[model samples]
Target chain A: MAKVAIVGSGFIGRAWAISFARAGHDVRMWDQSRAATGGARDYISGVLDDLASNDLLRGQTVDAVLDRITVVAELEEALAEAVHIQENTPENLDVKREVFSLIDALAGPQAVIASSTSALLPSKFTDHLEGRHRCLVVHPINPPYLIPAAEVVPAPWTSTETVERTSAFLVDAGHAPLVMQRELDGFIMNRLQGALLEEAFRLVADGYASVEDVDIGIRDGLALRWSFMGPFETIDLNAPGGVRDYVERYQTIYSNIFPQMLRRVDWAGEVMTTVEADRRKRLPKASLGDRQVWRDRRLMALAAHKKKSDREFGK
Target chain B: MAKVAIVGSGFIGRAWAISFARAGHDVRMWDQSRAATGGARDYISGVLDDLASNDLLRGQTVDAVLDRITVVAELEEALAEAVHIQENTPENLDVKREVFSLIDALAGPQAVIASSTSALLPSKFTDHLEGRHRCLVVHPINPPYLIPAAEVVPAPWTSTETVERTSAFLVDAGHAPLVMQRELDGFIMNRLQGALLEEAFRLVADGYASVEDVDIGIRDGLALRWSFMGPFETIDLNAPGGVRDYVERYQTIYSNIFPQMLRRVDWAGEVMTTVEADRRKRLPKASLGDRQVWRDRRLMALAAHKKKSDREFGK
Candidate 1:
């Protein structure tokens, strides 16, 4: 069994701890402030209870998984014996660079250092480190215990072995990694997401559709298929002949709309007011925390449903 | 309680017949060729059996729902007393215009005429009709009986009353209509879909990621929440404060990437080979039909799961 170290004990770090520990790894969590790591363990304890109730702890008891994660007093102690070191400090590039430098120097030479930064590329932070070859980005959708897709992005200077090792490690920890050929700005998920968001914002701003209507298009429509299949597979099955046939038949429709879609809609511009108003009307700001709990519960139920469905229907 | 006329008996028309009849509407299906209409019943019969087996026929027997849909010999007979007329003729502009002209002249003034054309705009076909104000587009993703979301797009000439009635009628028929204010080229679903597809194609074309990896990003990652909540609700709940807070914190990242996303990769170009090869490797061309069946079954199971989850979790 390999040891996993979490350098920053925020939400992302705590989430990584749950996934690593639940996967039967020994996890060590540490943060700059001692209170943060302590709070992370407490947060994880409550989450483990929720996960256990939802049958998501992989047949292990909550205490068993919780017992596998230890909050360490120092960053060096956390990284000392770890084969994999996950850096989840603040999103700022300078903060990440500084933290990665310390993790690189203190962690074992065999350790693969990974960042959970969704926004910053790996090169910006790790290029200055002495052991930069071992560093890559293992960005996750928040709360990795539930969401499994992570992006394994390597810097230009980073070794291919690091990418393979990180990808394999994520898979072992129950993640589906989108291993990149090289680094790009938004990676895969965000680019796809950003593409959709730009159109959604434009749809509302252009007075063609309402915020609710656009939501209905996805929530009730396109997303249903996307939950189980990707866009490529979706189009593959859409046409009789396959993906090529699908493009041949439908590419023109998208090509015509491509010019209109090129115009970027500023998410924080005038449309934000309408979007915020609609969201606030539907879900009052006061109950955001309660709704967050509800969202997590829904995700758990979906994950459980998917587990059963995958077994019955063939994964 | 109402008579609904389906002016074509293709797959979409048959699917619409099942949904409308299951909701207790007396559905009359007619097509230019009698054999096609005959085949539609045969197809719907098989689908109804599947729906019944999955407990998806809305607590009604397959025979009960099938009995409400009748194949009419003539268009005039079907349109005579119908409250709503759904035209599903060939998608060619000339064919739609000619068929719609005939439908307009024969149908009663009270009947709301809706086209199932996903390609052409409502105005393109309905402009010259005497009853143009009563006409609009009611586009559905195929097999609308299972997928409840449909785009109710209105032409410039379409009245507010027409939009309201169509939206209400769809809701009554167990559909979530994206009630669009004005008709655009791709409508809501396709526009959003097109945006994502463009980025997906670009990713493959630019050699940044593989087809399988991109698919995993959605099938496993982003689409989980999208199946229940939408983009607006997703970001609203993502941040601490709300949608505006999410925008304030994260919009810059998207805005920065938006420029890179503006360049459209020709989907029919080199990328088609890679995408098609990837898809074909997963499922050969011979198994496309079987995969389609699997997709439909998956959709049925997901729909059933969503129904229960929505009730238990509070929609």
Candidate 2:
């Protein structure tokens, strides 16, 4: 197991620590705030307890897994023995640049430094670094312990060897890493998310459907196919012959409706109010924690389902 | 249980017959072609056999369930004792118009007329009908036996009472029915599908990732959250506070990328070629049927998992 350094003791950083440690890596976590570091330890313990209860952990003892994570205040000590450094500081560009500079100064020559920034382009953050060749972005879905996909995005300056090594390391740490051939805004998952949200916002703005109904369109409708297979595979399976047949049959209708999707919404204004009001009606603000728990449980059930069925389903 | 009549004994029509019959409804299927009706009976029997192997049915006997489904050649005979009519003809506009006209002429006043057309506007087909108030589009995901979600979309002229009755009937039939507030092209499911396909095409076209990686981004990433909760509920429960907090944190990023989705593609060309080539690489044309069966088995297992764990962990 590699020694992994996790900078910043925020929610995402702590998640990365626990995920690495649970996968049997020796994880060193660092944060400027002592309180943040202390909170992360408690959070990690709680998460490990949750995983143990669910029988999702590979280790025999939660203590054994927790013992592998060392919460440190010194950045130099955190990066001293690490093979890869995962930076999860605030998403501010200036903050990221400062952190990456510090990381390059303290990290060993062979260590690969990666960020958990969701939107910031890696080139902007790592361009001034002396060890720019060894830096990239490894974006994980929230609660990376359960959801194992990571978008391994590289800047133009980032070496191919670094990308390959990072991919191998992430795979070894029990993550499915998708390599981004070029850096783009939102990467892969969020780009698809953006598209859905655009249409969802447009639908709500037009009063075509309530926020709840739009959600049902996905959760109950298209997402079922998506959970198992992707959109291309879905359309391929939908038509008898293959993609060609699917296009032949549905292309006309798709073309007819394609123009409607080009209609964009200002997601920042009245649309937000509409969605917020609708969502609040379904899930009250007071029950946010309960709803989050509900979301996690659903994710667990879904993960369990995918584990049992996806291979058989050819998804 | 309602006595359901399935008009047009194509693949979807026969599947509806078996689904309603499996749920213990008496089903009478009518096809213009005698050979098609015979084929539907055999197909329904085969599907029932598969369901029996999986312990999905708890009937007196497969023969008893099969006994409930009678194949009739005449439209009047099929609608004789039927309480609900499920029409699944070809996707031609004139064919839909003719079928609706015939159904309006033959079906009882109290019987609900629903079309299985994925693309046609319900108003266009049923506008000329005497029983137009009783008709609406009840679009099911393909192979409705495995996927239980049905979109009950009503046109501008569709009555509220009709929509409510259809929703209630579908619920009783063990299906999740989401009502569209108004008519729109592609309704809700396919529009969301269109949104996803647009971005997927853009990603592949821009060379951000391989077709395979984009598939993984969905099946392994966002789809995990979506299979259990709608996107609204997903974003609602994602952050610590709820949807409001999630938006506060990620809205800027989402807003930044939302414009990128506005860029449209002519999906009629090279994009199709790229996706087709990618699909053939993974699953050849010859292996599609076996793979589809694999998809069903996976869906069954996934559904079973959701059934089991949702009670325990789904909150």
Strongest candidate by lDDT: 1
Q: Candidates' DockQ values?
A: 0.88, 0.69
Which lDDT tens digits does candidate 1 get at residues A1-315? Answer: 799999888889999999999999999999999878767877899999988988889899999999999998988889987999998889998888888888888888999999999999999998888899999999999878998999999999889888888888899888899999999999999999999999999999998989898888888899999999888889999888888888899888999998897777778888888888888889899999999888888998888888878888876
Question: Scoring model 2 with DockQ, what do you get?
Answer: 0.69
| Per-residue lDDT over B130-177 for candidate 1, one digit per residue giving the tens place of the 0 to 100 score | 999999999998778888889999999999998899899999999999
Q: What DockQ number belongs to candidate 1?
A: 0.88
Error of 2 at A162 (Å): 0.9
Worst 10 residues of 1 chain B by lDDT: B34-43
Please state the error at residue B240 of candidate 2 in Å.
4.1
Q: Look at candidate 2 and tell me the lDDT of residue A309.
A: 60
TM-score, chain A only, candidate 2, equals 0.95
Alpha-carbon interface RMSD for all candidates, in angstroms: 0.8, 1.6
RMSD of each: 1.2, 2.1
Q: What is the TM-score of chain A in candidate 1?
A: 0.98
